[model samples]
Target: MDAPACAATAAQAASLQALLNTYLREMAPGSAVLADDRSTVEIPLSHIPARLRVRITYFSATGPHRFGPAQILFDGSSTWHSAPPVQVLTLIAQECFTRLNSRDAGQLPEFLRGLFNSNAGIEQNLIRHAGTPEPDGFLAAEQALTFGHWLHPTPKSRDGLTTWQQAAYAPEYAGEFRLTFFAADQSLVTLGSAHQAPADMLRQIPGLDGAFRLRPDEVMIPAHPLQAQMLRLDPQVQALLATGRLRDLGEAGCAFNATSSLRTLYAPGCRWMLKFSVPVRLTNSLRVTKHNELETGVLMARLLKHLDADGPRFRILNDPAYLTLTLPGRSESGFEVIFRENPFAGTDGTGIYNLAALTADPLPGRTALLTRLIQQLAADHGETPADTARLWFEAYLTCMLDPVLDLYDRHGIALEAHQQNSLLDLSTGLPSRGYYRDNQGYFIAQDALPRLNALEPSLTQQPALVYPRAHINERMAYYLVVNQIFAVIRRLGCDGLAPEPDLLLQLRRRLTTAASRLSGAGADFARYLLTAPALSAKANLLTRARNVDELETEAQEGLFLQMPNPIAAAQPQPVQERTDVLT
Candidate 1:
């Protein structure tokens, strides 16, 4: 590749850097972050007609850790000598390794290669993994390294050519990658001619590329074929009195509750949703596991992380009670106490099995943007076929509630955010609205609060009373943000609403505009809590939680909310065949 192409790649990546950061922060927070001086992000790369500007970092594009510690340097020119790695390589590798033995045509070599070639590092792995040991070092494991240049055949096909050569010409593969050498430890230490990274540079990054850190605890709703193979041996569970498999983290009074939100709930470290909450029924105690609680923490962290970052889908949740609790049952594994506030106070209602209704329709959220949500989400992302551009507007809400539980637990901080008292939105599945119905308010124990006085501290009016830290944050974002003033554009990303940019930009404008009208929610409410200054810094980690089982999120059209009136939706009319063939 030439300098211009490299520069273009850099430019494209740079231009969209802010946009991507904004989106990622909202979608996944643990991984999305800014550079030291806030100049770059982990995914700092671009593609142009000729060259690509690159940042060589030890990042897994598709792995659970999106932004691990990066060297944070750039490869000024696109050194074509070695393979050109795309920014999303690591993630692709993680996903590929995850889907290595899958039966889906969508995950075959050709498709996998496309995602991998996008990341230079992954392509190197592809080369190394495919090689065989030679007398000197190694030989091409499979002689003749014929990769993406020609489509690989899958087991499902017999009329092979139909699936290969006919593939659309979009330069389907990513940056080029050839064979590379791995050290005794299977690290990408040595490379052949295509080694663009110099020895010194290579030594700097070393071989932590595939380093094992934290295992992901995701629940797979439709259990991907490869996910089954990735489940590691279950870890021992932890509780106040005893220990066993994570599934057994409770004593006599543990709740065996569950959720159906997560698409995948069986990821190694994140499998069950049994130990986090107060025990409702004790009979199902044996069914809980550690994987369950871990997933809950992950989910909560993701939720709060998004709110802490800047995004168009900001939720006005102030409760930080969303964290991995060490209670009995599975709730202990995952975080507990989801804050029901504006935004996430709703559901997508995209039920368990809607294959028939989902036939020719694109993404349901994008399709119903106009009627489903505010006018903003419908306007963003473009008007392509629905299936082509789908975003999880429901995710925006689930993410909101899940985070409050996250922040509190991580800090060993607890807030009063009971689900029964919380309000959730069930309005249009994708397009919905959630608010602190009656401002039930955030609560803290009589003596353990005040740590966040800088945020909002005042002497407790009543004896032993403490301040509600989470509530303070909520009022700032909700009343001061989405409501109170109309200047800020509602950053609601409901599909078919205006594009995300317009909505967020408008939110900023409106937030500043109506900054003064937010006193109705209450002012002194936050100043009354106490802090648990004496609590130990080290928290007892939990293990027996699991994710909620996948259930029918999809429901009747009006399941989420009641319709103002039963207005009949017009069905699509068939179009007549065109007779212009002769003309």
Candidate 2:
């Protein structure tokens, strides 16, 4: 194979190995082969009894290693070599099914295909990004995620997109396309907004030229290109079109580039980011907007507006408006689109990056944005890389964790602050602020409803959105603690800036201090996080293997496994005097 092909194969194999290793550790703990020093361990495959060597990392039990370029082997011996990633995954799946006496082994082939497609998507994205001149800092960071979620088995998979469509709409490829617009009669449109009417919001968006002017009785709504095609075939949409209630305006306005979230698009000079409901399944769930989610967005915006009275440390990128068709019996028409506040509108010098993309490994041999930022900080301050890493992490925790916990403790609002939904704004290589987006993932605790209702009376109408305190803690523990913070610690370690244990120790110190300053439930939660024996992490591999739609599963109901808490495991050290790292 050629060099590029060989690299792609290696990436696929590495992803598969990561998934399998997670499964073995969680599902069959006794299968691991540990070294005397515990720095390196091996997992003996049940199907072949041959060990696959892995290097140890923080939080998780294992990290990636190079057995060979594209093939996995038993130790350094060439005698026992496994096939490609797909075949290896199939073998592991077969063994897992046989062990559990489950019949869902059939799902393995589909997941394997997804893995291949994901690899292809990454390859295409790399080629496109290499050929294209770099974009602005924020957009470049947004589109830089080639290989997606480090833990997901098929992070780059676009299940229903064709190769051409993938090139035109996938964010990694820097895809840009005109959004398809439709004119719906005023009577058929359901509008919701926290600030302005949905129709007014649509009218204010630039680049919708006079050629696509709306009539007095019609309201404009935008749809993704693929979603537009799907809408044309939908019975409800066709019925409305047949009755002259909905008019197809075709594709119009300026080209919008897809962001990291495939359905969300960004247009230069536009005041709002458009998030459309696409029917295609990406990763674990179909990208469709439900009515409740729209309602939740408006509610969240109102709550944030109330919270903003007391100067929030982080900004909530609110989805202020949504446009959707209101069919007689159908709650959602699959053409729902949200108008989210655009923070990048006027800031040309500042850098805003999706936290997930920032932490991801960049192209081979290239330093990731996080690593580059740390190196630059070290150079600027004349500090060691390790010290810079510790300082940078301190600032990050202060900016990110404090606000997240404050919201949960004070208002009962638990954000889905996973890496993808969270963003960090950096000023001169230091974290200046943090932002959290996504309306579908916010959770409100039942205990805080009265306070929230006092702030916004309409919030009490949807009691189902409220969850128990324990449930919120679990979700927050996974997303904020396990997936977000620990992932950053691991990345810093992997990049050689600092050892993972040192970072964990620093994090524990910070959390301990924060906990002392906090009160009530927040203080207890912070203390728990600092010394929890184990943490609940989403089991992405097992979740995908079960062919479950994560969105459908409740936050607490999805597959979870206990990962040893690095903070808890670290030995206590003398507390150092805190410095003004934020400066």
**Steric clash pairs (candidate 2):** none
Tell me the deviation in Å of residue 61 in model 2.
Answer: 5.7
Candidate 2 has a TM-score of 0.92
Model 1 segments beyond 4 Å from truth?
1-502, 505-515, 520-583
RMSD of each: 23.6, 3.0
Expressed as tens digits, the lDDT of each residue in 59-136 for candidate 1 is 211111112222323365433332222334333233332323445454334433433222222123233323322211
Question: Measured by TM-score, how close is model 1 to the native structure?
Answer: 0.26
TM-scores for every candidate against the unseen true structure:
0.26, 0.92
Candidate 2 lDDT, 352-371, residue by residue in tens: 87788777766654677688
lDDT of 1: 0.24
Candidate maximizing lDDT: 2
